[model samples]
Target chain A: MMSNLLLLSLAVLAAAILGCLYRLLKGPTVPDRIAALDTIGVLLLSMIAVLCMLFRTTAYLDIILVIGILTFIGTTALTRYIERGVIIEDGDAEDDR
Target chain B: MIGEMAIGAVVLLGACIGAISAFGLIRLPDIYLRSHAATKSATVGVLLILAAAFLYFLLYLDHVSVKLLLGIVFVFLTAPVAGHLTGRAAYRSGVSLWKGSVRDDLKQEDSSAQGPL
Candidate 1:
C-alpha cells in the first residue's frame, strides 16, 4: 500500500516543481533561468526517489543517477558559458568578441 | 506498529517542510534568496523522506535496498553544489539583488575592475 505520507510528500514535491517552472518561464535573466534549472535537477532526483519507493523497484535509480551526473555537468558548462561566454579552457571567450 | 507511525510522521513532516521551501522559492524576491531556501529546505526534506523510506524498506523487504540509500547519498552530495554553482552563475550574469539588499560590499571590488567583484 502506498502510504498516505508518501502521497503527501509527492504532492508537495509536485508543487515545488511547479514553482520552479514558473521561475524558469518568467525569469528575466539567464542565470535566473539556470537557477530554476538547477532546482529542476534536484527535484527530478527526488521525484525519482519517491517513484522508486512507490513502485518498489530500484530500476529507476540508475536513471536518476545518470540524470544527476548529466545535469551537473550540463549546468556547470552552461554556467561557464554564461559567465564568460565560453566552455573551453581559453579565457578568450570565443563569443566575447 | 510503531514503525509505521514513525514513518508516517516523518513523511508528513518532510512534506510540510518541502511545501514551505516551495513557498519561499515563490515569494522570495531574488534568485539568490530563493536558491538559499530551495536548496537547503528541499535537501533536508528529501533526506528525511529518504530516511523514512530506508527504514520502511529494511522492515518490509528482504531484497537489497542499500542502493536506495546510495541514491539518497548522491542527492545529498550533489544538490548543494548544483545550487552553489547556479547561484554564483546568477551573481556573475548580472542578476540584480533585491532593492532592500543590504550588502554592497562586493561593489567595492567591482569598482577596481575585478570582473563583477
Candidate 2:
C-alpha cells in the first residue's frame, strides 16, 4: 500500500511538471518563463525527495542540494539579466577602454 | 500501519498541491498572478513532500537524515526570495498586469518618489 501510494504521487508530480512545461512554452513574457522555470525547479525537488523515499536510500540526497543550488543561481542570473540586461557588470566599466 | 498511511497521505497531498499550482501557472492571465501561484503554492507543496520523505525514513528505517533537514531549510529560505526577484524583475522590465486587476502599490510608490508637480 505504501509503495503504491508513493508511485501514484510520483505520477501526479510528473503531471504537474508537464503542466509547468506548458507555461514555460506558452508564457507571453520572459519573467513568465522564468517563473515557470523556478516553479519547475521546486517541483523537481519534490519529485526527487519522493524518489529517494521510494528507493529507501540516502545516497541521492546530495543531488537534491545540487539541484537546489543550481536552480537558485539560474533564477538569480535570469532575473538579473532581465532587470539590467546583464548578469554581471564591471563596477569600473566607465574607466575601462 | 498508521505510520505508513500518514506518509502516504502527506505525499499525495503534496503532489495534489503541486498539480493545482501548475494548473494555475498555465491558466492565470498574467505573469504576476501566475508567479503568485507558482511561488507560494509550489513552495508549500515541495516542503510537504520533503517532510513526508523525512518521516518515512525516520519511522521505517530508524535512521536520521540530516541532509533532508538541510534541504528543507535551504528550500524554505530560497524559494520566496527567488519568487520576489522574479516579480521585481518583471515589473522593472515593464511586464503588464492582468486587465482585471486594479491594485499596484509599486506604481504608486514609484510615482510618489517624484517631486510634486
Candidate 3:
C-alpha cells in the first residue's frame, strides 16, 4: 500500500513538472516565469519527501531542506532584480559598465 | 490491514488532487488564476501524502520517525509563504491580471502608481 501511494505521488509530481514546463515556456512576463520556477521547487521538494518514505531513508530530507532554502533565496533575488533592475552590488555598475 | 488500506486511500487521494491541480494550472486562463489553483491544491496534496507517510511509519512499521514529521511541518509552514511571495512579486513586476479580473487589492498601494501627470 505504501509503495502504491508512493508511486501515485511520483506520477502526479511528474505531471506538475510538465505543467510547469508549459508555463515556463509560455509565461507572458518575467515574473510569471519566476513563479513557475518557484512551483517547480516546491514540487521537487514534495517529490523528494515522498520518495524518502518509500525508500526508508532519512538522508534525502537534508537535501530537500537545503534545496528549499536555496530556491527561496534564488526566487527572491530574481524578484529583486526584476522589480528594481539590480540585486547585487558591483558598486561601480551603478556608474559605468 | 486497516492501516494499509488507510495509507493506500490517502496516497491515492493525494495523487488525484495533485493531478487535478496540474490540470487546473494548465487550463486556467491567466497567471493569477493558475496560481490560485496551483498553491492551494498542491499544498493540500502534499499534506495528504505526508500524513500517509506518517501513518505508515508509525502504524505499520511501528517506528516513530521524527524526520518525516519535521518534513511535513516544514512544508505546511513554507508552502503558503512561498506562494504568497511569488504572487506578490509577480504583481509588483506589472504582470497584469486577466482582462476581466475584478477589484485588485495590490493596485490600491501607492507605490504601484505610475508616472507624473
Top candidate (lDDT): 2
The TM-score each candidate achieves on chain A is 0.85, 0.92, 0.88
DockQ of each: 0.50, 0.60, 0.39
- How many angstroms is residue B109 displaced in model 2 relative to the true structure, after the best TM-score fit? 3.9
List the candidate 3 regions with Cα displacement exceeding 4 Å. Answer: A88-97, B105-117
**Model 2 lDDT per residue over B29-107, tens place:** 9988888898889988999998998888898888788888999999999988998999989888888788998787877
Question: Residue B10 of model 1: what lDDT?
Answer: 82
Of the candidates shown, which would achieve the greatest TM-score relative to the real structure? 2
**Model 1's TM-score against the true structure:** 0.85
Q: List the global CA lDDT of all models.
A: 0.75, 0.88, 0.73
- Candidate 1 docking category? medium
Q: List model 3 lDDT by residue over B9-43, tens digit each.
A: 78778767777777777778777777787678877
Each candidate's interface RMSD, rounded to one decimal? Answer: 2.8, 3.3, 3.7
Q: Candidate 1 on B13-109: residue-level lDDT in tens?
A: 7766776777777788888888888779878877887777677777766555766677678778877887888787777777889999987776677
- What CA RMSD would you report for each candidate? 3.1, 3.4, 4.1
Q: Candidate 3 DockQ category?
A: acceptable
Candidate 1: residue A66 lDDT (0-100): 74
